[model samples]
Target: MAEEFRLRSVAVAVYGPAALFGLAEGAMLPVVALSAIDRGATTPVAALIGALLGIGALATNIPAGILATRVGERKSMLLAAAVSAVGLVLCLVNIGTGPGALVLYGAGVLLIGAASAVYSLARQSYLTESVPLHMRARALSTLGGTMRVGLFLGPFAGAAVMQFWGQSGAYYLSLAAVLAAGVVVYRVPDLETTAEHRAAAAAITTWGMIKRKWRVYATLGVGILLLSGIRQTRQTVVPLWAAHLGLSPTASSLIYGFAGAIDALVFYPAGKVMDRHGRRWVAVPSAFVLGASFVLMPLTHGAVLLAVVAMVMGFGNGVGSGIVMTLGADVSPAVGRPTHIGVWNELADVGSGLGPLLLAGVTALAGLGFGIVVSGLVGFAAAGALWTWIPRPSRGLRPAAVRGPPP
Candidate 1:
């Protein structure tokens, strides 16, 4: 009963903050380009400015990890939330349209991104330490699910606020959400840490930790990168193909939302399957389904066919919600775990950035359909890589079956 209580408490602590932070992120993301344009940025420049969030997150990943290691997860989360709040406040600043305003807005977005990196790493690390190995996937998957729920709800919230206050309202919503997240995080109790764990963590630098796990990083890391790339490509392919079919923006958004709804529904089940069976069960099928969907995308000539394909893509994505974090946790040592997770996040981000670039290049050289096909091929490759690398359960080792609550 005590164990169950602890588990539930941890859920409230960890998942609550995650959902709030995700809500902030979701509410703000859609309005970024619009805000940039309002600040007098050209179309291309606005797009570039919009990308600052990801760029900042990508750059801060490792540093965030190091900070988590030093300050511990809860404190790191609180600090990140504070920084995110500052960023959101900056976004609310109205300096009028010009280079100065654009630069200020970009800086605010960048800070938010950086804070996001820290918060994400901190939460994942906290869960990793708190949950037992057997329950890790479920815990992580639920974490992912909560974030999805927040993201799905965020746009609607933003839209509602915008009705009265315009695009800037989204920034206000984000600020409130992030501040709420910080308060939740601040109230959460810290997990108990062993002297041994602390000593071990303190002994190694992030670089040394990476060196020690180079083999895992090199092999499974490649698979993770490919998985991320394919996922990002899925996002791009759906909208572009909808455009190709000459679907109205409303039709395209409906299709995308349909897929997103499916995506949001599957995380818990996926995690349950992973904990009961193994990572491969969910990982292999997810990549395979995504790859197959992308491969089949070119053949869809109408909105109905495309929506079907998009739904399949969503299922593929949904099932693998926490696969990356789960895999990273599975392989991470108690020592330097934050650093390991940071590196893992970095690789995933790189893949995300690359996937779109690859699609664009291929589209430029060949065609959109071909570019999506290539991305599909990458998915197949990811499946193969994961299959080859993800460790199989030892004989008769059904961790979930034997579990009460993980020790």
Candidate 2:
């Protein structure tokens, strides 16, 4: 039998670094946006914080994947942690309020995003190798949930630090978290593929793997891009609009916290539904639910309505994210694991990055309602693609599809 604590142990060790980075990120939203406003950032400049971060992260994923394949999983995680640490510390420098602030914020988010993509690809691949297939989805759900616990706590931590320490102090505290993350990344055990496997893969570059698994990889990548775009708008633009409507920081954070909480709660049930039913069946309507939730954003005027939306959106995202990770892990062979995951994440990461920029643009041009509606349509298209463009069976994931809607 696998060691009882194996996944949990590794997860715990890395959990702090993952969670700490989030706490720092939590501070980032308020500090970045409000600070930009203070410095007179136009809507596009304000939105660029996310755009730049995406750009930075997009630059690193392929390289990180290459390194992870050559060096080992644990080592890549370490590098990611260390890079994130330095970037967060640099963010403490206050870099003016307009473009400078956006640049600094982008750099920090980019480092975090790039490292996180590698960190996650490695971790998920390792988990797939380590665990039984029957337990795989649950494992992904639990492990993913473990990190969200940190995210749930992080915004509050950021808000608290910002409340007392001011924005600079908040970044400083976030810097500390990055340092802690680096330590954990360095300590996690190496998960290198065996020499025999490496030798077999020697003939196959990362590009080779992508060329081989283009269909499944493309489907997952495209799906993730669409889903992530929707989420980015929800997280970045919607909050700013709500805040503009005079919502308190604490209330906003709490709403996010609630989403994170409900996300974890709903993950497994959604997974079982996906497993028992069809990917398209599970994905299409859930996409509709997700789209409808955003389209209804304008109708939300209070904590209760916000909470309701949060739960619905969170549940949809939890299911979708869990399915994709598990599906990617399922498709990625042990020989070229990082390559498969890199492509998988690269698409989603870029889409997520573009999302805030697009939403911010819409908000600048029209209003939050236009952005929300556009995002909804994007998600709806993704869902429709599942019915039309995506192939009949998702490779290596879920057993035979069950007939009905999820339980």
**Best model number under lDDT:** 1
**Residues 1-407, candidate 2, lDDT per residue (tens digit)?**
33355445545554455556566565564566555555557776666654555666677767766776777666767777777677666555565666666666556666766766666766666566555555555666656665665566665677677777776666677677767777776665555345886666455676887889888756666776787777666666446646765788878877776777777566556656654564565567667778887777767888778777877888777666455666666566656667777777777777787776777687779987787778778778767665664444444444321111111
Number of the top-ranking candidate, with TM-score as the measure:
1
lDDT of 1 by residue, 1-407 (tens): 53485367777788988899888988998999998888899999999988898899999999998888877888999999999998888888979999999989999999999999999999998887777676789989999989998998898899999999989889889999999998998788776666776677767787898889899889999999999999888878999999988999999999999999999999999998998899999999999999999999999999999999999999999999999999888878757888989999999999999999999999999999999999899999999999999866784223221112223
Query: How high is each candidate's TM-score?
Result: 0.95, 0.80
Kindly give the stretch of ten consecutive residues in candidate 2 with the minimal lDDT sum.
Answer: 398-407
Off by over 4 Å in 2: 2-9, 13-17, 34-46, 94-110, 240-257, 271-285, 299-307, 354-371, 387-407
Cα miss at 20, model 2 (Å)?
3.6
lDDT of 2 at 221: 64
